[model samples]
Target: MTHIRGEVLIRRPVEEVFDFVADQRNEPTYNPDMVFSERVSTGPIGVGSRFRAAVGSGRRPVEMRIEYTAFDRPHLIASTTTMAAAEFSGTLTFKSTPAGTVLRWSWQVRPKGALRLMGPVFGPIGSRREQRTWARLRDHLEAAAKPPLRPGPVPTRFRRAATSHPPAA
Candidate 1:
C-alpha cells in the first residue's frame, strides 16, 4: 500500500473546480502527461459513471477505466480504477477560503505484480510525483480560470525530488 497526498488553493469557485476535476476528461489541459481523457459511460456525474484516460503523451501512458464508486456533489468525489495492474482510488474535497477555493486530493494506489516490488524504493518517489502533479494541475486550473499573469509563460514544474530518481514518472 502507498499513499500520495496534496492540496492546492485555486482562485476558481468551488463548484467550478469541483466540476472540472470531477470529470477526468479535463485533466489533459493541466496535467501534461494526460494526453487524452474521456468518460466511458453515460451521465454528467454520479455513481456508476465510467471513464478511461491515457496518461503519457510521450509514450502512451497506461490507460485505466474506472467507475465512480461514490459521488457527493460539490464536496466529495470517489472512483476506483478497473485495471488489474493498478488500483487507484481518489477523493477531492473543496472548501471556500478568503483567497480562493481550497482543493484537496488524496490518492491511495496499490500497484500489483512487478510494480508492487518497487513500492519500498518508489513509495517516496510516487508520493512526491503525485504532489507535483497536483500542484501543476492546481496552478493550471487557476491560471485558466483567471487570466494570465504576463504575456506568456507556463507554470513552473513542481518536483520535490530529483527527476533522475526512480519510481519512473
Candidate 2:
C-alpha cells in the first residue's frame, strides 16, 4: 500500500473552497489529467454520492468510479476512487484560516495489474501527481476569486458627459 499526504493553502474562503472541491464535476477544471467527470448518483452532493470520471488522454484513457463516504460541510470529506490500475481511499480536511482556507489530504493507494510490480516507483509518482493536482486547484480557485478588472476606459464621447471637467463647448 502507498500513502500520500499533503496540504495546500488556497486564498479563498473555506466554504467556497469546500463547495468547489465537493463537486466532482469541477475536477476537470483544475486537474489537467481529468478529461471528464460527471456525477452519476442522484440527490445533492453529499455522502453516498457517486461519480464517473476519465483521466489521461489518448486512445485508452483510464476510467474511474468515485464515491463519497463522508461529508461535512466546510470541514471534511472522504471518498474512494477505483480504477483499472489502482484504488484509492482518502480524506480531505478543510480549515478556515485568516488568509483563507487550508486543505489537507491523506490517501491510501493500492496498486493492481502491472502497476503492482512498480512498487518502489508508484509512491513517488503518485505523490508528485497528487501534489500537482492540488496546487493547480489552489491556483485555479484563487485566480477565479479575484475581482474582475474594471471595464476598459469608456468611449471618449461617453466619458465626456460623466467627467467633472466638461469639454469646452
Candidate 3:
C-alpha cells in the first residue's frame, strides 16, 4: 500500500469549501489530470453517493468509480475509488481556521495484479500528483473567492437611457 497526503488552506468559509469539494462535478475544475467527472447516484450528495470519473488523457485514460463512504458536513468526507488495477481510499477533513478553512486530505492506494510490481515506481509519482492536485485546488478556490472587477461606472448615456423609459405599469 502507498500513502499520499496533502493539505491546503482555502480562503473561504468551511461550509463553502466543503460543499465545493464534496461535489464530484467540480473535480475537473481544479484537477488538471481529470478529464471529466459526473455523479452517478441521484439526489443530494452524502454518504453512498457515487461518481464516475475519467482521469488522464489519450489511450491510457483511467476510468474510476468512486463512492462516498463517510460524510460529515463541513467537517469530513471519505471516499473509495476502484480502478482496473488498484483501489484507492481517501479522507478529507475540513477545519475552520482563522484565515479560512484548512483542508487535509490523505489517501491509501493498494495495487493489484500487475501494478503490485510497479508500486515502488508509482508511489512517488502518485505522491507528487496528489500534491499538485491540492495546489491547484487552493489556486482555484482562492481565485473564485475574489470578486470580479467592475467596469469604471456605467456610461452616462446608457444610464440615462435606462431611466428614460419608465415602467409600463
Tens-digit per-residue lDDT, 129-168, candidate 3: 8888878888898898799998798889999999999889
lDDT per residue, candidate 1, 92-169, as tens digits?
778878887887777788888997887665558767776777788778877776655675544355343445478756
lDDT of each: 0.76, 0.93, 0.91
What root-mean-square deviation over C-alphas does model 2 reach?
A: 4.2
Q: Write the per-residue lDDT of candidate 2 for residues 20-95, one digit (tens) a residue.
A: 9999999999999999999999999999999999998578778999999999998999999999889999999999
Most lDDT-accurate candidate:
2
Comparison by TM-score, 2 against 3, better one: 2
TM-score of each candidate structure, all chains considered together: 0.78, 0.87, 0.85
Q: Model 3 scores what on Cα lDDT?
A: 0.91
What's the true lDDT of residue 119 in model 2? 71
Would you list the clashing residue pairs of candidate 3? none
Cα lDDT, model 1, residue 137: 74
Which prediction has more favorable lDDT, 1 or 2? 2
Better of 1 and 2 by TM-score: 2
Candidate achieving higher TM-score, 1 or 3: 3
Instruction: List pairs with backbone clashes in candidate 2.
Output: none
Candidate with maximal TM-score: 2
